[model samples]
Structure formats: structure tokens, C-alpha cells
Target chain A: MLSEKHLPAFYALGALLLIILPWILTAADSSYLISTATRLVIFAIGAVSLDLLIGYTGLVSFGHAAFFGVGAYVVGILAFHNFEETTFLGFDGTLTGLIVLPLAILISALFALIIGALALRTKGVYFIMITLSFGQMLFFLFVSLEAYGGDDGMMMFEGRNILPAIDLNDRITFYYFCLAIFTAFFLFCHRLVRSKFGRVLAAIRQNEDRMTSIGIRPYSAKLLIFVIAGAGAGLAGALMANHTEFVSPGLTHWTKSGDLMIVVILGGIGTLIGPVMGAFVFLLLEEFLPIIFHELGMDLLKEHWRVVFGPILILIVLFAKTGLYGLIFKKEG
Target chain B: MTQLFFEQLLNGLQLGMFLFLVSAGLTLVFGFMNIINLAHGSLFMIGAYAVAVLTNLTGSFFLGLLLSFPVVAAFALVIELLIIRPLYHRDHLDQVLATFGLILFFNEGVSIVFGRTPLFLNVPEALSGAVQITDTFSYPLYRIAIITVGLMVAAILWFIIVKTRTGMRIRAGTTNPEMIRALGVNIQALNTTIFVVGALFAGLAGGLSGPLTSVEVGMGENLLILSFVCIVIGGIGSIRGALLGALTVGLVDTLGRAFLPDLLGQFLDPATANGIGAALSSMSVYLLMIIVLIFKPTGLFPVARAA
Candidate 1:
């Protein structure tokens, strides 16, 4: 009854459950669960976007978090300007989601274009290191911007951006809003990956030489996918900043990229729904690991769970070739 | 202005030496083993921590430095055998992720063991005083010593890599591992040796840097990125490239940080000048790297592969 062939039905059932999760939690008298679910959906957006480049295009970008950070900063900077009643670079910083969300996506895409253009010149480990350096450069740039609260980061005094007919202030409304965007984006990505462009990306990943011989320029193709991924990450960042009402330089840190990479890997790279599963598992572990350690009376272990997490990661790389998604799907097919 | 220029130049050279110590090992590993060890920074951290704790116990900085090499080497040996060896054949992403996992592990593990408080290591009394470089400019003796030690190690490494029998095998291994294996060299043992040696160099950089900077958890990470920049700019897998790249990075960073704000103050408002200068100077090395990549995608000194 639960074979690999029925995976899509299972995914549909899971989506239905995710859709009604907040209601179920509210009925169970758990308001906090809704917030966690919101975070899961937001991070899943990022992880899934990253999977586009890493899983499909074979571009291991260690700076994907930079786009995410830039997106959040666009929201944060605008809000900061609005709160201070100051014009930012000759424009009134608006808090309309309609304006800000698109702005976030465009700015992030532009950054990805520049960085990806340069970083794509190098291959393999060099690409990883260069992307990391670019990310760090952005991180430091934010840290030095004293106007935007500098190293301490900025807070959103104004609530969520206004949307006509949508009261985002309500926890359930915000959660569902995020879910709606995430679902749409996920569908877009699923369809995109199955398209001709996705086929070109996969071909480049498998054999760039062959693709080049076949008249496909890998650079433009990879760059296109990279921008798409950045835009997706930017959307996630905008939503995240609204949900938390805060933005920090930590969002762009290399470790944040690593976390996203972990989600992709844990979910099973190249799988459409795998990143969502990965984000859920990662967030759940982050939430419950401390409690699990506390129950065992290992408070120090609870605090330093990464000590255990590191070896588990190594073991996963060495042993689990397909990851958790593969385990659930029973086969990669 | 001339005195200040010379002083900043010396500072740059000093920073370059510390970078060279780290980059050399990283380049060597990449060249021969083709493994990108992200936990190389953790090895640097271990070196500093070992020296800090040992120096505190023994009351001798020299003894602590001497002890750190073996300790770090042993740790690296274990890691190489158990962890890094398996990763050699895997794709770069898996290696990056696994090693990244190691970084998280080591950072937290050190934090757990050493506590969250930063550890301090003082320059030895013999090296603490300033040395007169000129009539108007005096340089710290400890920094000069770091430069000297780095050069000596560089020379020694050159000798080993160029002239020694082991060096020939390493060179061969880098160009063609299968051929070297067919020639009766123990490629496994050679890899193990190279890893240990690289770890020792990283450890040395950390141990030496302890007195100059705060010896704390995660300190090696920033330095690790800088060293990667060095290798990338100089050309991956080439010792000459690492040295050149390290010096270039060191000079640019030191001189930029010291002078950029003042330089910008003349053109812009002081507040904006300082803020923008700080950001730009921090970004200067990476900008250099990007420019180099654009002009020479392989790097400034790419190692030649055997046909």
C-alpha cells in the first residue's frame, strides 16, 4: 500500500495535512506550533530554491544566503526609513508588500547576476570558496552600515506590510499566506525543473563538454537558474523578515548557507519535495534536540548538540548516499 | 608619512607570513590529495588552544609551541585516516558538506571544553619589546620574529618540496597519482604525511597568532577564508602561488585598513568616508580575487598537469 509508486498521493496527503496544521494546532490549544510551522514554511522556501542550483544545476553555491540576506535587508532598510521618516537615497521607503516583495526579488536577482557571473568562472572547490568570500563581503558591508543598526541589526517597528483584504497581523492568516506563496513557488519550481531549460541544466551538470558540443552555453544556462534561485530565496527572505519583524547580518553568514545545504542534502538533493522534508526534519531537530538531551540529564550536550550533529553529518555523507527522502521513497525513482 | 608607510608595509608583510603558514598547507592538500578540508580551520583552532593551555600550564611559550605540533599532527592523523581519506574520491559538494559538519563539530567541541570565554596568550618577555627599524620608526620585535619564522619555514618547505626524495614523490603524486603508485611509492603513507605536515603548518600559524590576537573559538574561520583567497589568487596547488597570494592579501588588507579611511575623508563627509572605507577595505582582497579570476580563470600560478 505504501510503495514508491504512491509517493505523489502521499505528498498530496501531506500537503493537505500541512494546510490544516494551524487549525489542528489551534484546536489542540497550541498557538506556538503555528509560529514554528510558519518558520518551517519560510525556510523550506529557501532550501527548495537552493535545491534548484545545487541539486539540478550542479552549482554548489556557498553564498546563497547572501541573496536571502539582501532580500531581508531590503525589507528592513525600507521599514527603518519609514520609521525614521527619512528618505532613503531620494525615495520614500514604502511598506506595501506589493512594492517591497518585488523590490526584494529584483535586488536579489541583480546581486545573483553579478556574483554568479564572476563566480561561475571557477569550478568545483574554487567556486565554493569564492561564493563564500562574496557572501562574507556582503556580511561585512551590512555590519558596517551604521544607519541600519550596524552589527546589532534592525528591527521592524512597523508591523507586517499592508496587503489589501489580507490581515497579516493574525497568526493563522500570516501562516497560510506564507504557505500559499510557498506552494505556488514549489509548483513553479517543479514545473520548471521538468522543462527544457531544466533539461539543459541537468545536461550541463552531467557533462558540460557534451552540452557545449551540442551548442548549449553552460554559463548562461547556469546563470539563469542561479538568478531564479536567488529570486526564490529573496521571496523567502522577504516573507521571513515580515514573519519575524527583524533582520540581521547573520542571515548572510556562510553558516546560514551551510544550514540550507544541509536541508537539501538531508532531504535528498535533486528531489522536488525533498527540500521541504529536509527543512521540516532540520527544524524539528533544532527544536527537539535540546529537549531530548535535557531528558537524558545531559544539559551540556543539549547546548552543544552540534558536537553530535557533526559526526552524524559525516556518517551521512559516507553511508547514506540518497538521504532521508530516498529512505522514504524506497528508491530514487 | 614615509615612516607610517614603512610601518604599514611591515605590518602587511607580517600578516602575509601568517597567511602563508595557513595557505601552504591548504594548497598542498588540494594539490596532492584533491580534498578540500574545511575543517583545516579547526586544526588551526586546536593548535592555538593547545598552545594556550600548555603555555598556561608549563609557563613557557616555546614549550607550548613545540608541544602543539605533535598534538595537532596526531589529531590530523586520526582525522585523515578515519574521515578525510574516504572523502578523497567523493565529489566536491560532499567533501564541503562533510568538512563543514566537522567545522560545526570542532567549534562547538572546543567551546564545550574551553568554555565560551576567550583565552589570552601574551608575547614572551624576550619578544615583547620594540626593535628600532629606523630613527623615527620602531617595530614590535614579536612581529619581526613571526616574519622571520615564517620565512624560515618557507625556505624549509621549499627545500623539502623541491630537493628531497619525498618532495619528488609529492610532485609526482600531484601530477599523476597512479604513476607514482606504480613506481612503488606508498601513496597512502605519502598522503598521510602530507596531511600531517599541512596540519602542523596550520597549527603553527594559529599558535604563533595567539599572542597577536585573541585565541578563541572560531578565530580560525576568518583566517581560513583569507588563506583560501591567497590560494585562489596565487593559483591552487602551487606553493609559489600560495606564498605570492598570501603576501599580496596581507599587504592589501593591512595597508587598506590602516589608510583607506583617511584617504576617503578628503573626498567625502567624514562619517560616510569612514563607513564606506571600512566596508571597501574589508572587501578589497575579495575584489582582487574576482579581478584575477576574470583575467586568469585558473589563477596566477596554476600547477601544470602531467599529460
Candidate 2:
């Protein structure tokens, strides 16, 4: 008899089968659709970072975008003098923008350290609101830096500083780069879940107090994961800036944060690949609604795509409460 | 400096009053229900929309307010019954997500219903002028009226909670729901009333803010977050805490924004001062919140006895 504890890998195989549907999406002449899909994957990376904290680690953070925004803004500020500013780090201010990923990751990890150090002192809703406040502080900081575009975010004139002489700005190259990053992040996340550290995180999630009673200080582990998650989000943000060639304060808005949370919850949080799947569906819907509304000639709905999204969110919460993955595949205890 | 100080004081008070009105209902519902209502802000948004549209249609702001509160409260009651009540025993995580979804739906619904352009809620001619507060600076008469009305609401709310039989049960319900239920009190009825009251307060606040702000989509979100901060500071379930939190937040935010830049300019370069000042100004209230949490995690007046 099937038990409540375990799900088969066939579900994941099915997921992999669908993720490549984007090849068909490239039918349009321009890489607009592909890039959009790429952008969604980037956000999925960030969402997955959050899911690690929120879904599996049992911590709800409303400020993951702080890491993402910081990552984007770092690139924007560094590349200020150069429109397609590549390598100042290694190649005399002429490196490809992709080469700057380490810098973004490091900075975001540092931020998570300060944030997590203070924030870990609180728990429950306090944790959520405190993280949110930190994000707001960073948001205001970015908004105040007029030189870096202030409320109006700076547009990237060039692609990332790629290493090894790869064509960094090429759309296809960046698309594949994003795909590789997601794959690596997915695999990395999968391994982490099955590792000892992952088990500690899961144990903490199931019950932190009990974990504490057993002599495992959940705080250190949680903070460690927080840094890792921040690094993941920062990498995603870097890729996003590279992919879109634009970065804005909208990157740190609370609503954007909410969307990430929704994606995490929607994708079946604990499932390794769920966040990416959630992001794909989310962005697809985000794209599809406007086109459908336009085709249907509901001129009013052309701009109200979010209205459609909101009810869909409600329905997901109400009916498909386990999220798409959970609805399809039950988790093992 | 005195004049500047006085100006900041008034600004803080005005901001505090607005927050107090909104947070009153939020804290109560959160306290009694243990449910985090992210959609409460949507209810606030809807209330503002209703008040704005009705005021425009009827050409009577007071009438609009009169009609708006009941309708908003009713909507809240219906939501509680249809959507919220059943989820009471469900996981808190589920409630948070659902309410979050509600916020999205409502924001989009408003966008669809009302054109994206910001709606202007015209101040009534009756309250358009200003009352002189000092030499060189006279405050708007309508804002003064708003403060006065807010104060009156606060007084009545205090009386209702402190004096009435219903208030007694509500207070009991907050402290020990099991006890209240065991004593034959219908918590369903109480929860509904609390929800209605919360809606009414939010609606009134929305109606109040309509004239001061551009009434439009997502208007309630900022206010909602601020009010949550207020409730947190005030002690989530304590009405007294909400009031104090509102005042504290109001003062810090308004005063910080009004003068922090100039204060910094005295010591730093004009541009650097402005940039850093703006950041600090926006962060003052949140800074205050962090300090509060550090000292008093449960807040100034936590209602629930145990965790």
C-alpha cells in the first residue's frame, strides 16, 4: 500500500520533460520570449533560495529581495562608468559582466550575515517583519542613491563580464548560462536536502525546540543556510541584470517579495525542483493572461493581468492547497 | 528650531492619528483570532474606494462615510464567515498564504474596476480652510477635523471595550478562548463582531486618508505595513499598545522626514547629507521598531497570557 511518507522520482522525470518546452517558445524571431523565460528562471533561483529558508527550514523571510536587489545594485554601481561595463576586477575594467557574479554573491552573503545575526534573535512573525524592515531600509538606501538611478533604476548597457572569452552578451549564450545556473542550483539543492546539513535543517523545521533538546543549536545551521540562500539569490539577481540589461528599485518592492513567496509556496516548498516549476508557471501565467485578454478583446483586462493572477492565487491557496507538486505528488513522512 | 520642532510635532500627531484608526481594528482581529490577515489592507483599500466613489456620486462626504463603514464591515464579516472562519483551525501558514492571495486579488480587482489613474477624493468645501496654529504656519482645518474625529472614535472605542457586556466577553476571549467557550459564550458571534469592528475602523481610516492621499490601487499596502508595525509595537493584542505604537511610529516617521535631512546638512556636504538623510528618514520608524523588539519582544502590551 502507498504510504503518506514517500513520493517517486517519476514525478521529477515528468517535470524535466516539461521544462524544455521553452525550445518551442523560441518560435518568435526575437529572443524576447526566451529571455523572458530566462528571467523567470532567474527569479526561480531566488524563490528557491527563499524556499530553503521558509518551506524546509521553517523560517518565513519577507526580505529575500534585499539580497537580490543588493546583487543587482552592486552590478549597476560598479558598471556605472561603462554602459556594457565588463571587467574592472581582472581585465582592467573590461571584463564581461558575468565575471562579476562572485562579487555580487559575496556582498549579498555579507548582508545576510549582518541581517541573520540580528534577525535570528527573534522568531515567528517578528522574524518576518524584521526581515521586511531590513529590506525596506535597503530599499530606501537604493532609492536615495540618485547617482545609481535612485527610484529610477539604471539600465545595463552591456552584458556581464564573462570569463574564458565566451560571448557574454549573446542572448543565446546568456540563456544557456541561466539554464546551467538553474540546473546547478537545482542539483546543489537536491544534494543539500539529502545531506547531513539538510537533515538538520529538516529536523529544525519539524521542531526546533526538539532539535535544541537534542543538543543541535538550530541557530548556527539556520544562519549558515541563510548565507547560502542569500548567495543563491544574489547570483540570480546578477543573471537577471545580465539577462534583461536593466535593473530597478522594483526589484526590492514588498509585492515582488510576496510574489516570490507565492512562487515558493505554489511550487511545493520542500520539493527540490518545486520552486523552479513554480516560477515557470508563474511567469507563464503572467505572460499568457495579457495575450489571452488581448485576443479575447477584453481591452480592460489587458492591463489587469494581476487581477486574474490574484484570484488564481486564491484558488491555489483554497483548492490546490498543497501547491501543484503536492497536489500531484504526496510527500513521504 | 522651535518652529521646525513645532511643525514636526503636528505632522507626527496627524500621522499618528491616521495610523491609530487603521491599527485599532487590525490588532483586535489579530489578537482574538490568531490569524494574520494580509487582506486587511485590501479591506482598507476597498473602504477608501467606496468612500471616494460614494462621496463623488452623492456629493456628500459625510453620507459617503456613513454608507461606507457598514458596507465594508459587512464585506469583512462575509469574508470571515466564508473564507476566514473555516480556516481558523487550519495551519497559520495556510492563513497567511490565503490572505496574501486575497490581497493580490483585491488590488487587481481595484485596478480593473477603477482606472489606473489615481483617484482624487475632493475635500469637502465645508472643511477646506485652515485654523491658525501659529505665526507663519496655519494647519488645514480639515486635518484638524480629522484628528478631532479620530480622537472621538478612540474615546468611544475605549468605552465600548471597557464598559459593555460585549467588551467583557471580548476581553475574556482574548485572554482565554477555551474558557470563554466553556462558559457558553459563542466565539463565532464574537469573532464576527470583532471582524466587523475591525472593518469599520479600517473603512473609517480609508475614508479619512482618501482626501489626504491619492486614492488608488495599492494605496493601502504602505499603510497596511505601517499599521502592522504599529500593532507589533503596541503589543499585538493590546488596544493600548496599538495606540502608543501608532503615536510613536507617527512621530518618528513624520519628524524624521521633515527635519532629518536639514539636520544632517548642518554637518555634511549638501548632496551626501541629502542622500544619507533620505535613507535614514525613511528608516527611522523601522529603526524604532527594531529597538522595541530588542527590548520587548512580546510588545508593550501583549494581550494573550501565555505564548
Q: Please report the candidate that would top TM-score against the real structure.
A: 1
- Model 1: colliding residue pairs: none
Candidate 1 lDDT at B221 equals 92
Tens-digit lDDT track of model 1 for B121-237: 999988999999778789999999999999998999999999999998888888888899999999999899999999999999999999999899999998898999999999888
Where does model 1 sit among the CAPRI classes? medium
Residue B265, candidate 1: Cα error in Å is: 2.0
After superposing candidate 1, which stretches have Cα over 4 Å from the reference? A1-4
Q: Individual DockQ of the candidates? A: 0.78, 0.62
**Please, what is the TM-score per model?**
0.98, 0.94
By lDDT, who's the top model here? 1
List model 2 lDDT by residue over A1-333, tens digit each.
Answer: 223344445545644644653666665454478777678778888988998898879889888898998888767666665654444445434334554778889989999998888788778877887888888878888888787788898876655655676676776676667777887887798789789999999999889999999999999999999999988888888777777667788898877778888898788777756777798788888888888999999977877787777767767777776687776665665
Model 1, A176-249: lDDT tens per residue?
A: 99999999999999999999998999999899999999898999999899999999999999999999999999
